[model samples]
Target chain A: MMRGLAVASTLIVVLIALALFMRSKPILALKPLTTLLFSTAWHPSRGEFGFLAFIAGTLWVTLVASFIAIPVCILASIYLSEYADKRLREWIGPFIDILAGIPSVVYGMWGVLVIVPLVKNIIAPLFGGYSAGYSVLAGGLVLAVMISPVIIHISVEVLRTVPSDLKQASLALGATKWETIKFVVMKRAMPGMIAASVLGLSRAFGETIAVMMVVGNVARIPRTVFDPAYPLPALIANNYGEMLSIPLYDSGLLFAALLLLLVVIYFNVVSKMILSGSKWSLYYNG
Target chain B: MDKKNNIHVRRLEENIFKSLMVFSTGAIVLALALILWTVIRKGLPHLSLGMLTQAPKSGYYLGKDGGILNAILGSLYLTGGAALLAILVSLPVVLYLNVYLKKGSPLAYIARFSFDILWGIPSIVYGAFGFTIMLLFGVKSSLLGGMIAVTFLIFPIMSRSMDEVVRMVPGELMDASYALGATKLETAFKVVVRQALPGISTAVLISFGRGIGDAASLIFTAGFTDSLPTSLLAPAATLPLAIFFQFGTPMPEVQGRAYASALTLTLIILVISVAARLLTRKFTKHVV
Candidate 1:
């Protein structure tokens, strides 16, 4: 009976994948996968379903978020794991948990009020341009803040697993504290850091309401960070309810969801591989 | 002199990097403070007792009077139902992994991997999948549909979290139970379950917090209604959706209400976090 339960639990992932694929079959039968993925035109009224722009938008937002989040989170995690005293670490733990627990909607609402204005009145103007503030940059900035706790939490865990003996040995060899961290600690934590960042990337990729709220849902490829773009998750979220009136529109949205699921799974599998291959696996599996 | 200068330069570099790390950490804390301040400052004025007690009056979206009572209640019902369902599924799978399966078993690994993938899959995909299921069953977007979708979204989270705690139960304890002539099932139920109850409860609360806060998964499945849902089949309102819809309106007053809703949601989450921490502390007195 226990084995039956376990097997059934494992099958859920397969079941979801199958259900999404089956739901998307109508669109796949109507159009080739390449055209669906490569074309930029998206007219639900007339059945022109193209996902290229949305995919590009998702990539751009995730890339921008990663560029901002990775370095900052790594630095913070280093401080937390290597430099922070017991008291400080204890205080910061609940803060990070609170950051993580805050709902995406609340984040979105905050983004709309604070980040949007900052971009519109200050950041964009400083760049010698004007924006409505609902742009890829805005989305990316909010997403960066949103994913920071995830990356930092994981990276700190990974960094803490670097044995103190190694750091002591480096110090005994006359290496500076910085040198010990940069060479001895970071070298050992590289694969785990990659896994942490990849996990963050997966999160930023799949995040919906928060990014959608700020990303001015225009269905076109954005050429600049200040321009607006519609991401794949947003595409499905905003259109799924109304798509029932149009033929194949529902299928198209489901296909977008399928695309998201596949990419997230891919990233997760890659990170899991990196994690299992590293010494951090001991820390994790234990 | 050259060697001394080089040492000075290295010391400067160390200081610079240390300061940079401090600055980055400071920036994250500042961002959190800023978010909280913005929510409180904006939402405070609009957050009244009427907003808590009353449903949206007619033209509420047009800046008329109304509260998010429907959304609060609906969110409670939806998340409560989903958390219950997820616990039902997650407990068995988590127990089967830690108790029934041997350590390092391939099936256990496969199950964990699958759950990790499921956990990574966007809530939007779950929403879409839930909608597909609803279509197949001829069900409308309703409380039941929302619960189903949220169950999928939080099941992995609950399972993985519970697995972590259950896995921490000492092997010797199980061995002791076995030596007492207990069956594997009895050991799992009486020994492991008792030990892991704190963590299991924390897992449930955390999943509940997540499920209540999630909007993307319920957007399609929980079709929004202004009125409180009377049955599982009726469309339900949720706090996140309430904020989203209210913020989308052109009226400033309605948008303000959105901030108020956001504030309410954040407070709910804060309470859950604190409660989970306290509960863990309270319950761990029994564990060895």
Candidate 2:
């Protein structure tokens, strides 16, 4: 078992580092890294370096998308885990799981043909926006729908794990269902919920194909949700082939990938803090 | 008396809200059903036997000339290959975590951290990683690279789920087996796995479902080849890739083909999901 654990842990990090290092060597040559990562000029074929535009675009969509999804997922999870009947829980649980498994490419396809049109013609007008099919609003909205299931699944499971005795005692004292859930159940499950939400947030942040198809793949400052923008993932995939024209361009793209990778790893570490039941003790110590 | 009547009114309203909430619990099902219906409505008309046999040549893409023969075969190979690779990589890690790591050991903590990190990384990032790793060995975009990327993507999920099966092995059973002079490995392999077979099987099925639906990460790693793959290193296209590439074309016939492919992909994913749920329910009943 010790040997196995050693192999597992050591291998993952090595694989991760090797995987990044082999692709354009961002750490080995840090001299140009600053200019590559921060410059807003994104002309790849000409060897110019910049990722500020992609970084801004990615954060913009993620913020808008998370804003739309987080509240709804929290409420829905509470309803299913604490309040729903066995029959309702039976179908809803698996349905959400299955929804999460749907490929990002499928969502992209739906976005191009269906969601793009809907946003362009219907949602845009309501929000006082333009009707460009592939715009920031379309991308963020699709991402929210794509990732909402992850948020719901993880949050609901954590809520369900709250102690039954606590819930029963509250109810036995004549506390109403909503009151019991609002105060007692939520408090007990708070840490786990935060962990699960962090997990969801990371999952949403890392999602690639779904957002790429709809994000309009243009390199620019995202001043408007209606404006077209390019994210790191989309930029990597879309321009990597075209970037073959210049090695520095390829290297710049690698740095962008590294940035995205670090962001994901950061979320992973945060998720662990939530998962190992560490925060409860850390709080008391602090 | 007026206060009492107002309280009564409020109680009635709460009851109505509670009942409504209970029924709204089916909202997920309704939402999925609606989405599926919309996709099918738009997608099914584009599907036919032609999609499985003939290859699209140009703008018209009509008649028997509109099949994703390469994609159909390529998707199966990549999906099947990736699923197999993930199951193999995860099984050992999960087994170790379940069997050897003490409940409070730092090794166990690190093991979990590894799984969390592996799961957290996005598919696109994995694709980029896979490309770089393979590129060093002089491998180009190919089915092998795609499979490797997806393996990384799904390995953590299956490992986590499989560990649940491991943790389910009754501690008493392990103790009893050890008390009989069995080695820990023998006991874990022989007894624990046997007892947790059903759960492990469910994990495999879930991983397969996830593997089939994966698309974005595979795109750059697995360049779409219209011909059936002759070697693992050869570029190949899956259904999702076909849908992505073909959908962008202005041709109605090609677009229809893309929709048809989507229909096929959805049906496959939905079937595995429902099957997994039913199988899990059966396992619970048997356990009781």
Candidate 3:
């Protein structure tokens, strides 16, 4: 019975991929892959269905979020694992969990109330630009905050796996604390940190409701961070309900879902490979 | 003099980097505080007992009479059903990984990798997949469909967390059970399950919190309704979607209700987190 259940468990991913592909075959058959992927037009009423703008928007937001999140998370995790005492680390644990636990809709609401205005009136203007507050910057800011906990939690675990004796050896060789961390601990933990960041990127890439709320869903390529953009997840979420009315519109949205699934799977598989191939897993599993 | 100057420069760099790290951590904590404060300050005025008890009345979206009792109950029902379904699948899968499979079994490793990948798949994709299944089966967007979608979303979360705890169960304990003439199945059910109970409960609660708070997976699976669902086939309202719809309205009053809804969701999640922590602490005394 257990063996049967385990086999069934492994089949779910295959089934989901197959199901999505079958459902989206109509649109795939209608248009060449390049036109569907590279064309800029998205007028479903007129039978146009290009996904380039949404893809670009997804990449842009994920990139902006990575810029904001990666440094802060790495620093914070380093501090927690290296500098903070046990009591402080224990206290911070629940805080990170709470941050992760807060519903995405709540984050969206907060973004609308606070971050949007700050970007509109203060940060954007300081840079000699104007924004309505609902822009790629707003979406990226919210997403950065949303994915921080994931990166921090994983990176901290990775840092902790770097044996203390290695650090001691560096210090015993007359290295300063910062130098030991930079040369020894970070060198040891690099693969794990990369894995953590990749995981965070995947999480940010497929976020839907929060980004949808703040991202002022325009389907054009954004020229600047302050411009509105539409992302793949948001596109699927906003249009799936109404797509049944148009020809192959439902297929188009399902195709978007399929694309998201494939990308996320690639990221996860790569991170898994990194984690398993590194010496960190040997230390971690042992 | 040259050695002293070098030491001074190194000290300055260390201090600067340390301060930056501290500031980054502080900024994250401050963002959390600001999010909670914004929700409370805006939602507290509009939150009332009626909002928890009564359904929305006519013109409710226009800032009129009534509350969001339907959504609260609907969220509770949907999460409860999904949690039950997920636990059924997750527990068996987790047990098989820890108890049935060999330590270095390739199948176990593949199963875990798949779960991790599934966990990373966005809720919106699950929503779309659920919609596809519904189309194939001629099932409309209803409570049953929502439960099915959420089950898929949380299965990996529940299974993987439970696996973490169960894998920690010592081999010596299982050996003891076998030496006493117990079968592997008996040992698993009686010994390993008892040891991992605390972690299993925490996993269930955490996944429950996630299912309750998610909006993307339910947007297409559970069609929104003003009234409470009367059957498994009936449409249901959820707190996250309620907040989404209300906040999208043009009126400030409706927008205020959205804040209140957000506050309600946040509080529920907070309670679940605290409960998980406390339960883990309380139940850990029995473990060796």
Specify the CAPRI tier of model 1.
medium
Sort every candidate by lDDT, greatest first.
1, 3, 2
Worst 10 residues of 3 chain B by lDDT: B1-10
The residue pairs in collision within model 3 are none
As for TM-score, the candidate ahead, 1 or 2, is: 1
Tens digit of per-residue lDDT, candidate 2, span B140-236: 8899988888887777777777777787777888889999999878887888778877777777777777777777678668888767777898898
C-alpha local distance difference test of each model: 0.90, 0.73, 0.89
Worst 10 residues of 3 chain A by lDDT: A277-286
| Tens digit of per-residue lDDT, candidate 3, span A213-252 | 9989999999899998899999999986689999999999
- Model 2 chain A lDDT-worst window of ten: A277-286
Q: What range of 10 consecutive residues in model 1 chain B has the weakest lDDT sum?
A: B1-10
Q: List the residue pairs that clash in candidate 1.
A: none
Docking level of model 3: medium
Tell me each candidate's TM-score.
Answer: 0.97, 0.89, 0.97
Off by over 4 Å in 2: A1-6, A21-34, A168-175, A278-286, B1-30, B54-64, B179-181, B283-288
